[model samples]
Every structure is written in C-alpha cells, then in structure tokens.
Target: MAVEAPFWFTSLAGLGAVYLSVVFLRLLPYLVLYLRQPKDLRRCYGSWAVITGPTTGLGRSMAMELARLGFNLVLLDLHPDNLREVSDTIREAHSVQTKTVVFDLSLVGTEKGDEAMRRLREAVEGVDVGMLVNNAAVAKPGALYFHEADVERLVTMIRVNAMALTEVTAAVLPGMVKRGRGAIVNVGSGSTVAVPSFPLYTVYSSSKRYVEQLSSSLYVEYKSKGIDVQLQVPFYVHTNMLSSAVKERMLLPAFVATADDYTRAAVRWIGHGPIAVPVAGQQLQWFLAAVVPEFAHNWYRLRKHLQHRAILWNLN
Candidate 1:
C-alpha cells in the first residue's frame, strides 16, 4: 500500500517549487532578450554616432562595432594624435566617414570648455547624429581611504566622470530632440550597481551612482520625445583602464571580460532598456548580490578593498 508524504515534507516541497518558479520567471525575459536579434541601430536611431573617449577600451571597441554596422562616427578624445589614428583606422577598415574632435573632457565647465563645446556643437550641427556614447571616465589607480586621496585628483575624477558626461549629453541631446529620434548611452560602473558600498573608491562609485540616477530620469523625461537614454553598467572589463597589478590579483581572471566581449554584449542591448548590465554573467552576479544581505555585501567589499590596498603597497 502506498503511503502519503508527511505534512512538513509536502509543505517544504511546495515552497521549493514556488521559489524555483519565481527564479525562472525573473530570468525568462533576459533569456529571450539575449536570443533575439539585435536592433538595427542605424535605422532605428540615425545615420551617424558620436562617441567620447574613442581611442581606448570600451569606447574604441564600440566605435569599431558601430562603424561596422554602417554608422558614420564622430570620435572625441583629449589626445589629438590618438583621435586621428582611431578615426583613420575606422575609416580605412569600415569604409565609413569619421570626424575626429580633439576635445578634453576635463575642460568641461571652464571657459575653455565653453569653446570646446562650441566646436563640438559645430561639428555635429548639420549631421544626423543618431546616438551619443559617453564612455570616457577616470578612477584612482588603487583603492585608498577617502581622507588619503588627493583633493585635486578627486576633483578631476568628478569632472571627467560626472560633469563631462553631463556636458556631452547636453551637447548631443538637443539635436537628437530636434530630430525627434536618438539614443544616449552612458557607460556606468558595476562598483556602484553591484555593491552596497565601494569603500575605498568612494568618489568614483558615487560619481557612477550619479550617472545611474541621471540616466534613469532622462530615460523617463525623454521617452515621449522619441529618445532612448540608457545606462550600461559593466563589471570588471579587462582594459588599459585597469592596472596590471590589480588585474592580476584583485579579481579572478574568470570574472573579467575582455573589452570586445563586453562591447559586443553592450551593443546588443542599446535602445532596448534604460538600465542594463550587458553581459549575461554579470547579470547573474547582479542577481546573486540582490539576494544577499546589505551588511554581507559591505563586509565582503571592504575585505576586497583591503586586499587591493595591500597589493598597491607592495608595488610602491
């Protein structure tokens, strides 16, 4: 004769089933998004794209990818020679037009910044600029207490990461609004999104948090105007921006994505969502963080920073 299961066992099994179903439902949309075809960026947004800090890292890869997809580029950077080189390379490889704008992001909000903005405005004034990628940013070479950080460096970091992003977006958005269609992609950080507190890198994380908030508000404000504003948060992309020492010891190699890998995943999500963690693996990381307690996150992050600080000390 068959026997019925115990009451507690049946209840526990039912709870397990419900939890698994919730997890699956939460993940199903992202699974579908990953499998679907990428949008026609040029056709959906515009004929031309403007990218800041286009000479390296995520900027360089994104410029190349967008050019491959047939968008003419306006490349902006502080280094004139580097800008010219990237422009020439994209032109030669993709058979697409490229305009190099040598503008220092640090100059934004200064008198010289006014002149720089004027030049940037003039560069894209008559063109069909369908998208703007604000990818340029700066961070301290290593983690340190906020009190130990250089005041000048902190100001510069804020200017480059926060002010410059704002100014560049302002320079690009009015035109996009006039045209009534465009995409604005602000490259953000996983430090801000994935953790409760980024202890030693306080200013950097705080600046990125600003990016996240601004992007969200802009997305809502401009959605009715046919503009798509998205904040693309990436975690541990292996690029020149990361020092060799930290790259080697601080984070596991398995967790780090190459710039190309990140950008390819990044491009696919453009114009689709306001906030996106482009890599699927990073999305999983975000989910795991969500379930963990805030205190646990803070404690773990603090330990990581202390380890990072020790590595920096040895190098010095």
Candidate 2:
C-alpha cells in the first residue's frame, strides 16, 4: 500500500532542508578559508607595514611577526629606546628594513600631532607599506564608572583609541586603494561582545564598539578593491596592558596569553578577517557567549570584576 505524507509534514521537511542548506552555504567558505593556509599577506598588500604602538605588547609582537613575514616596518611609538631596540632586533633577525617614528597618538589634532604625522609621512615615503595594524590603544586605570573617571583620562582614552585609528587609516589607505592591494587589521575588544556590559569600562567599551563599527563598514566599502579589512576581537594577552582582573588571572589559560603566543596566532590569521580570536581559549569564550543568556553572562562578568576590584583596590 502506498502512503501519502500530510501537507504540513512535507512543508516541514522542505523548511528543514532549506535551513540546513543555508547554514552549510554560509559556513563552507569560512571553513575552507580556515582550513587552508593563507597567502603571504605582506606580499599581497605591499612590502612594508606600519604598526602603531609597537614599543610593547601587541604592537611589538605584531611588528616582529611581520618582520618574519619579510615585510619591512615603519614602527610608531612614544618610546625612542624601545623603538630602536625593536628595529635592531628585527634587522638582526630578518635582514628587513626598519624605520622608527616616535609619535604620540594622543597628541592628534594639535601642533604636535601634525608634526608627528609629517614625520611619519616622511618615514614611510620611500617604502611600500602593505599592512597596517592599528593595535595601539589606551585603557582606563582600572574598572571605574563613567562619573568616577577623570575627564582628562576619559579624553585621552578617546584620542588614542578612536581618533588615532581613524587618522592612521586615512594616512595609509589611500595609497593601498590606488595600488589596488592592502590589508588592515584593527585590534578590537571582546568586552564589546563577550562581556557586553563590561560594567566599569564604560568609555573604553564604547570606543571599542566604535572600532568594530568602523572596521565592519570600511570592509564593505573596500573589499571589492582588493583590500582586506578585518577587526580582531581578542580577549586577553599577558601584556603590560592587562587590567587588574586579567593580571590576577594571568595563570589561567582562558584569562591571559603571553604577547608572543598571542601575536603568533593573530598574525597567522591576519587576512582571515573581518574578525577572529586566534587564541583557542578566547575563541571558546566567544562561542559560549553566543549560546548563553544575556543576564547570566552579565552576572558572571560583574562577579569577576567585583572580585578583582576587592583584591586589587579593596573596593567592595
């Protein structure tokens, strides 16, 4: 005997097929990209990469990584001695060219900022800059509410975190567009996503959201022009930049990573854009955030912050 399925049952089966198809279609390319090794991004973008804030932490690490990738560097930072050291190290290790530009990003929009930019342009003039890592940013002293933060501190954070990124991108992107090749890796915060509320880092959180937005929109605008723009949302690295909470949890795999380890993973994923967390632990944290309830995540984050505050500053 032949049996016929009900109309609703057939419809449900069709819908299920469509859903699976959509999911597979959306995920396949990213999976393929992830599985395959990326092309030499430095060769594709240009021969030189200008890294801001390369004196220490993420900046220094990325600069070193790029040097290994055979790209000459124009390293910008506030410290002259560190800049010279990084340059010497890169040259000694890789035989690639290096230029050090001691510039203060916070001084943007002033006479000093203009002078700095002029010097920066001169430093990069003869080189073909291929990659731009906007990794330099200023974090608040510790967890503090908006009202509790000093106005100058808040303003400096905005200048370094937001304004500097915009200005630096503008400085280099035009050449990339004209040359028909380039890649930008703007380091972003997981605070805006993994811990969205981020109770005490109000301004810093907002500034990171701005970076995410800027990277995302610009990616859309320039992807057709052979430019790769990506925002990397890394959770934590055991650098001098770590806040008290992360510093306390430095031994935990999920909480902190050394700059060298983090940078190696991050540099490999450079063109894997528009966002990625190369550290497996941080990547897992991102996954859990997606499936977890908002209120629950908020409570968990708040608890960690409050506990760290008590330990570090004796705040209740």
Candidate 3:
C-alpha cells in the first residue's frame, strides 16, 4: 500500500506541483516555437538586419549568423576600420549586401548623435530592415566601487547602454511598422536575473535592467502590430568583452559558451516572446535565481565575484 504523507507535507507537495505546473505552462509555447523555418522567418521579418556594435564579440557573431540566414545588413559601431572589415567579410562570405555605419552611440544626445542618426537614417532609407539588434553597450573596467568610478565613463555608459538603444529603435521601428512585420532583439546581461545582485557592475546591471523592461514593454505594445521584440539574457559568452577580465583562457563549457554558439542561439530565438534565455543552462540559471532565496543567490554571486577578482588580479 502507498503511504500517505503527513498533513503539512501533503499541502507543501501540492503547492510545489502547482508552482511547477504554472512555470511549465508559461514555458510551453516557447518550447513548441523554439524555431520556425528559416525561410519563413526571413519572409516574416525581412531581408535586412541592423546591428549595433557589430565590429566585435557577440555583435559580430550575430551579424555573421544573420548573413548566413540570407539577410542583408546595416552594421553600426564606433570602429570605422573594424566596421569596414566586418562589412567586407560578410559581403565576401554570404553574397549579401552590407552597409557599414560608423556611428558613435556613446554620443546619443550631442551634435555627433544628431549627425550619426541622420546619416544612419539616410543609409537605410530604401532598405527593408527587418531586424534591429541593439547589441552595443559599455561596462566598467574591473570591479570598482561606484564612488571610485570615473564620472565621465559612467555618463558614457548610460548614453551607450541606455539612450543609444532607445534612439536607434526610434530610427528603425517606424519602417518595421510600415512594413507590418519585424524583429527587434535587445541584448541583455544575465546579471539582470541570473545573479541576486551585481556589486561592482552596478551601472551595467541597472542599464541592462532598463533594456529588459524596454524590450518587454515593446513586445507588449508591438506584438499585435506584427512586430516581435525580444530581450535575450545570456551569460558568460567567451568574447573580447569577457576575455579582458580574466587571466585564464576562456573556453566553452568552462566559461559558459563561445560567442558563435551563443549568438547563433540568440538570433534564432528572435521571436520568442518578451524574453529569451536561449541556452538551457542560462534558462536554468534564471529559473534558479527566481525560485531560490535571494540570500542564497547573493552568496553565490559574491563568491563568484571574489573568484573572478582574484583571477583578474593574479592573486590566486
């Protein structure tokens, strides 16, 4: 005979099952629609994709993947030579048209921003831009206290991480709406949810939190308009951005995932509703952050922070 649990134990078990059911129901649709046909995606979204910060790391990786999927691109970044190189590489490799826009998104409200936005707008006037990847952002070097950080760099971080994404969306969204279909992927950090709190990376974390909210709200406002806006929260991509911080050689399975693998997953998940933690490990990390106690998450985050700091400083 099956043994019955005590009254409180049975009640707790029932509640746990209900919680799990709720979580699964929320995840069911994304699991089913993880990927649609590439051709169908192209037809729905369009042939052109605009990627900011396309000169290096995750941004460059995403640009290449999009080109392989048969999308023309408008690539933007502060690095002119790198931008040109990326554009030429895409053109040579994919037989796809490419436009390189050397725009400094850090100057979002200045004269430079006005000129850059004007040029960017003119550059993509007749092009069918179906995707916008707001992938450019800046972070503080090392884990420093907020008071110890440079004020100028902090301001630039806000401009690049927050304002620039917003302005670029303003520049591109109307055309997508007019075309009646498009996809916008806002790149966000896993620190927003994967960790209980970010200490030294305060500004970057807050900026990503902004992107998370912006992407979700835009998804709600535009989904019925045939536009898909997804915030991709990914963790520990082994890119230049990450490589600079640690002494050890960054490797996949050791340092989360490689840039190529991460970007490929992120690009294919463009229309996966408001947020997409594309990697199974990252999804699980996010889930743990949500379900676990805040104190537990904080302890883990703090422990990892010290380990990273030690490695970065060669103190280990």
Candidate 4:
C-alpha cells in the first residue's frame, strides 16, 4: 500500500526546506570572516602585540614581522621549548621586548581555562596590547570519517580554533575598545571559500569559517568604536603541518603563496584599509568559486581529481 502525503503538508515542508537553504546561503560568505582588512593597530608603535601559535608557521612569521615593525610581543604556544627558542631569536634579532607564555590554547576554556586567562592578563598588566593574532590551528589529515578518527582530536581542534580564539578576543577587546584603537587579525584558510572533498577537514574548515564570520560581524559592530578586525584567508604555504603530498599540491601556481610573501603583504596592508587579501591572485579563485554555477564548480573539482590523483589539488 502506497501512503500518499497530503498536498498542503508536502508543500509547506518543501517551502520550509527552501527557506532554510536560502538563509544558509545568504549567511555563508560572511560566515567565516576570512578576509583581513587594514587598520593602524600600530597607533602605539613599539607597543605590545599578542600572538597565539607564535612558535611556527604563519604565526611565527607574523610575530617576526611585527617585531621588525617595532612592536613588543607576547608570544603564546603549546610547546615551551619552541616558544623559548622563538622568544630568544626575536629578542636577539629584533632587540625588542618579548614575553613567552607556554600553554595549550586547546586546553584553555575548561574549568582551569578561566584561571589561565586571568593569569595571562595579570602578567601583561600595564603593557598596552594593541594587536592580537589568533593564528593557531591543527588539522588531522584525510577525510572526516568520524568513526575512524579519534574524537579527541576534533575536540581539540574546536577548542583551539574556535573556543580559545573567542576567549582570548574577549579578554583583550575591552582594553582596545576603551582606548578606541586596536587590531585583531584572525588567520583562516582559502578552503573556506569552497567545500573540500577531504573528509576529516570538514570540522577544521567549519571552525575557521566560524572565525571568519565572527570577525566580520565584530568589525561591523566595533569599527565605529575604533576596533579593527581583520580576517586573513591564505592558500597553503610551506609549513611543517602539511604532508609532502599536500605540500606539493599546494605549491601549484594557483594555490601556492609562501608564508613570508603573504605575511609581508599582510603587514604592509595593516592599518591601511578595511580588509586585505595577501595574495590578490588567489582572490580570483575565490571569486570564481563563489560566482560559478554549482554544477560547473563540481565538474571542475571532479576534473582535478582525474587529472591528478592527489586528495587535494589546487586549481592552478
């Protein structure tokens, strides 16, 4: 026996689905706040800049660049040894004041997390923190087959990527707002521009998208108050985080942007404008992905898979 649905009921359900879809689509781009705008956080040059994930990769690069620009730094990382090494390097090379706080950002928001932030604030008391870079992130390779991967890894990713960022921003924003000047730069990925075929990256990408969106909304809300929020979306660079295959795929003409190249561009654009895309050429890819028809985009992604057997292949 075939059970037929009532016409009115089916129509209403379909309409609801369509409405939800439209709302999500409208909110998607701004969802990740993945672009960083320029703002003069250096209003107090030689002042303090707080950087998370500062021991390596893009975060380390940003720290060094800021040091060169005459900003003292408070560097945070999970690895104490690496943090000490980086702190020593910056202090010696740049001859600037530096502080190293070694703690796992992923651990900071639990019952013990609140105490940690309090301690951090107390330690940096009276030091004007003018810039905050939320750049620490971790990714477990391959597709997101939930059952296959350790759930704890995903939990940590969310904690560091989303929870820690929110907590740190909340901790420092009041000071910036009170002073009527400050810059918050959140590092994100170009992958948020489109859904990747890689399974496990879904959680990581979603978390980044959350950061981007939060940054955008915060910018809108705080710009008049003199708080500058910038979200940076960059393609893959040479970082220890990626596997060799991933590195090779990222270096393709379309997808590659070196850490130094992107960081220099980002710093130059800081305090100069509202948002900055370090690699302007990469912006074209984002535009294409956003504007192209869904069918065509899917076809493009499929073609890349066929052309190269790589799990993640750049369009270039």
Candidate 5:
C-alpha cells in the first residue's frame, strides 16, 4: 500500500504542477513563432538608409554598421558635433557616402524644424532612400506622476517620437511607393509593452506605443505595394537615454545589446519583412505581454515597478 502524503504537501505539489503547466502552455505559441524566420529580410546590402538620432546609441551604431554593409547614409540629429563625428567615422572607415542633417525633430513645423527637413529633402531629392530609421527620442526624469510631469516635454516628446516620424515617413514614402520598393524601420521601446509605472516616461512610452501601432497598420496597408514598414522593438539599452541609476537597475543578465548589435540585427531583419524584435529573449517577453491575461500582465508590471525601484535604491 502506498503512503498518503500530508494535505499541505499535496496542495503545494498541485500548485507547482498548475504553474508549470501554465508556463508551458504560454510558451508553445512562441516556440512556433520563433522557429519560422520570415524570408524577405535576407538581402539588404547596398541599400540607402536614412537614420534619425544618428549621433548616439542605436542610431549611431546603425549608421556605422549600415555603412560597413555598403549602404549610403543620411544621418539626422540635433547635435552637429556628434553628427560630424559619426559622418567622418563612417566615411573614413567604410568609404560610404554620408550626409548629415542637424535639426531638432521635436521642433518640427516650427520655422527652424521645417527649414531643416526642407533642406534635407533638397539634399537628397533624387537619391533613393531604401530605409528610414526613426530612432530619435527624449525623456525627462523624476516626474513619475502625470500632474507633476512637464507638459512642454510631453508635447515635445509627442512631436518628435510621433509627429516627426510620421512626417519623415510621409516625406520619403511617395518616392518609395513610386519606385515600388523601400523599408521604414521605426525604433520602439519594450517599455511600451511592459507599460512602466514610472510616470516620468509615461509620455515617452505612449509615443512609442503609437509608433509601434502605426507601423503595424502601415505595414498592412503597404504590403502589396512592395514597401516594408518594420517596427523594431528593443528593451533597455545602455544608452544616454536612461539615467546612470536607471541603467544600473535596468541592465538585464541577458546580453545588453549594444547599439551596434541592435543596428546589425535590425538592418538584417528589416530586409526580411515587417515587425522585427531585435533582441531574442525580449521578443519572448513581448509575446507574453501581448497574449497574457490582463490581470497577470498587470501583476507582472507591478513586479517590474518594484524591481525598478529596488534597482534605483541599490544604485543610490
């Protein structure tokens, strides 16, 4: 005769079984999705790429990598110094033709911003831009609550992250459509998926969410037209965008992909098709966030908030 287990032990064992079953059930769809790599992104060498926020982080790294891959570059940024450095580096290192446009994308529609884009358009008027990277972004820290947040900054964030990307896409799209080929790579954040409780970056994340959604809708609209619009979702990267304290806390155990890593993966996959998640592990995280139960997802978000706080405190 078999010995009967204690009630508490039996209950714990049953709970563990249920948890494991839920995890496996959630993972099955991702496993299938991950195994099937889309075929269109394999050949992207020699394409012309226009990269916004091209002076630092993922944007800068992408400009360099694309140049190395034999693509001509149109680099846009607010800082002329950094833009010059990046252009010179790419020109010397890869011998690829490079153009630098210095303009505050957040200020678009203003006399200065409009002039900048107009000048950029004139500079590259006839040149075919095979890819447009909408990667520039900004955030104001410490104001975690809505009431405390800077309205001006929020407006600026929307202008740059949402409006500018839209305008730049519009500026380049007619030519791309007329030519019947091109790609638009919009850089989005994982925060949009996790929906961080940090109110300071609320506007920033919201804008990114808009980009991701718009990119997807545009992809569907233009698929038959031969224009691939890709949404590149990335998690926390070691960039100037985050505070030092936040960076220390947000850095994951998994490879904190450098801008170069992101750029390479992004450019390669952009050619494959629309909607590429550059980081592998984080892609799973995104998938789970998308399909998971709302309550469960909110619980996970709460845990993330706590984790972010803990990381910030530890840094201090």
Candidate 6:
C-alpha cells in the first residue's frame, strides 16, 4: 500500500499541475500555427505589397520573398540608387512589376516631408496595396545611458522607428479598409516583449512597445473588417544592423537567425495572429526569458549591455 501525501503537499502538487495546464493551453494554438502550412498570401490579402526601407536587411528579404510569391511590389526607401538596384534585381529575377518610391521617413512631419507624403499617397493611389511592411527602424550605435546618448540621433530614431511607421500605416490602412482586406506586418524587437527592462537600449525598445500596443489594438479593431495587423518580434537577427562583435558572440544557430531565414518564418505567420515570434528557437528563448523574475531580467540586461560597451570601446 502507498502512503498518502500530507495535505499541504497535495495542495501544492495540484496547484503546480493547474499552472502547467494553463501554460500548455496558452501555447497550444501557437504551436499549431507554427506547424501549419502558410496561407495563400496573394489570395488572402491582395496583389501588391508596399515595403518601406526595402533596400537592406529584413525589409529587402521580405520584399524579395513576396515578389517571389508573385506579389507586385511598391518599394520605398530614402535612396533612389539603392531602390533602383533592388527594383532591377527583382524585375530581372521575378516576373512581378515593381514601383520605386524615394521617401525619407525621418522627414515625416516637416514641410518637405509633407510634400513627400503627398507624393507617396499619389504613388499608391491606383494600386491595390494588399500589404504594408513597416520594416524601417533606427537604433543607437552603442549602449549608453539615456542622458549620455546623443540627443539628435535619439530624436531621429524616434522619428524613423515610431513616427514614420505610424504615418506609413495610416497611409496604407484606408486603402485596405476600402478594399475590405489587407495585412500590415510591423517589424518589432524582442527587447520590448521578451524582457522587463532593456536598460541601455531604452529608446529603441520603448518605441517598439508602442508598435506592439498599436498592432494589437489594430488587430482587434480590423479582424472583423478583414485586415490583419501583425507585430513580428525577432530576438537577434544576423543583419548589418548588428555589430560584427555581437554577431560573433551570437553565433549559435538557435539563438540568432539570418534575415532571410527569419523573414521566411515571418511570412508563414501573417494573418494568423496579432503577434508572432516566428523563429521556433526564438519562441523557446522568449519563453525562458519571460519565466525569469523581472529584477533578474533587468539586472542581466544591464550587465550584458555593459559588457557590450566594454567590447566596443576597448575598455576591456
């Protein structure tokens, strides 16, 4: 015969089981989504997709992927030469048509910016813009205290990362609403969603927090209207955006993904949810990071940023 556990021990065991059940239930849907085949994006959304900052990194990769899948593209970036290069490359490789728009996102609220916005509005006027990838962003070159940071650069980061994303979304959402369907994929940082405090990278993470809240709200508001607003949060992508030293340190395949690899996963999750951690490994990393206490997350991030600073400045 087996001995029965004490009353407190039995109660504790029951609670632990209940907690685990809740977590499993929460994660079940995302697991299903990750395993499922991708939606026919052209059928579900529209024919043409607009990608901002489409000249480099994930934005460029996303543009190419969509074009490969037979979606016409409207590419927007600050440089005409780079835009022309990408447009030519896509035209040469894919049968899809391309439109290049040179718009400076940092000039979102200025006089020249007003004219540029008007032009951008005109550029997409007749196109069935089924998707908008708000992929442009800026971050500090190094980890530094808020007060120690360059004020001008921080302001530009806010303008490009947050303000411009908002403006571009505003520009594209109306058409989607009128057409009765569309998708907006806002590139977001895991720093905002995966941790309690980002410490030295405060501004970038905070701006992404805004993107997170906005995307979730839009998803709720537009789901019935046939619009899917998704925030794709990535942990660490091996892109030019990251320093060579940091990339070297993050050489683990599971921890850091290439831009193309991450974008391919990102495309699979569109229209399925308001938020997605596309890379399966990053999903697990996010879960473990979230399980840690807030104090520990904050302390660890601060220490890591400090070490990064030491490496960059040769202080070590």
lDDT of each: 0.90, 0.82, 0.83, 0.73, 0.75, 0.87
Cα displacement (Å) at residue 278, model 3: 0.8
TM-score of each: 0.95, 0.86, 0.88, 0.78, 0.80, 0.92
lDDT of 1 by residue, 1-316 (tens): 9999999999999998987787777677678877898799999999999999999999999999999999999998999999989999999999999988888888888998888888899999989999999999998755888888888889989999999999889889998999999999999999888888899888999999999999999999999999999999999998876678888877787778889999998998898879998888888778768878999999999998888888888888
Q: Which candidate model has the greater TM-score, 2 or 5?
A: 2
Off by over 4 Å in 2: 1-35, 243-246, 249-251, 314-316
Off by over 4 Å in 3: 1-31, 34-39, 244-255, 310-316
Summarize candidate 5's per-residue lDDT along 163-254 as a digit string, tens digits. Answer: 99988888878777887888888888887755433334568788888998999899999888888888888876777776667666556647
lDDT of 3 by residue, 1-316 (tens): 9997899999999999998897787566556655455335677889899999998889989999999989999999998999989999999999999988889999889998999999999987978899999999897555556886788888889899999999999999999999999999999998886776987678888889999999989999999999999999878777766545463543346547778988877766777668888776667556656878889877876666666556666732
Q: Which stretches of candidate 6 lie over 4 Å from their true place?
A: 1-27, 250-253
* Ten contiguous residues minimizing lDDT sum, candidate 3: 243-252
lDDT of 6: 0.87
Task: Please give the clash total of every predicted structure, in order.
Answer: 0, 1, 0, 17, 5, 0
> Candidate 2 residues 5-94, lDDT tens each?
999999999998986686566455546755788678767789999999987888888888888989999999988998899899999999
Q: Supply candidate 4's per-residue lDDT for 272.
A: 42
**Ranking 2 against 6 by TM-score, winner:** 6
For candidate 5, the C-alpha RMSD (Å) to the true structure equals 4.8
Top candidate on TM-score is: 1
Candidate 2 whole-model C-alpha lDDT, 0 to 1 = 0.82
The window of 10 residues in a row where model 2 has the poorest summed lDDT is: 307-316
RMSD of each: 1.6, 4.4, 3.0, 10.8, 4.8, 2.3
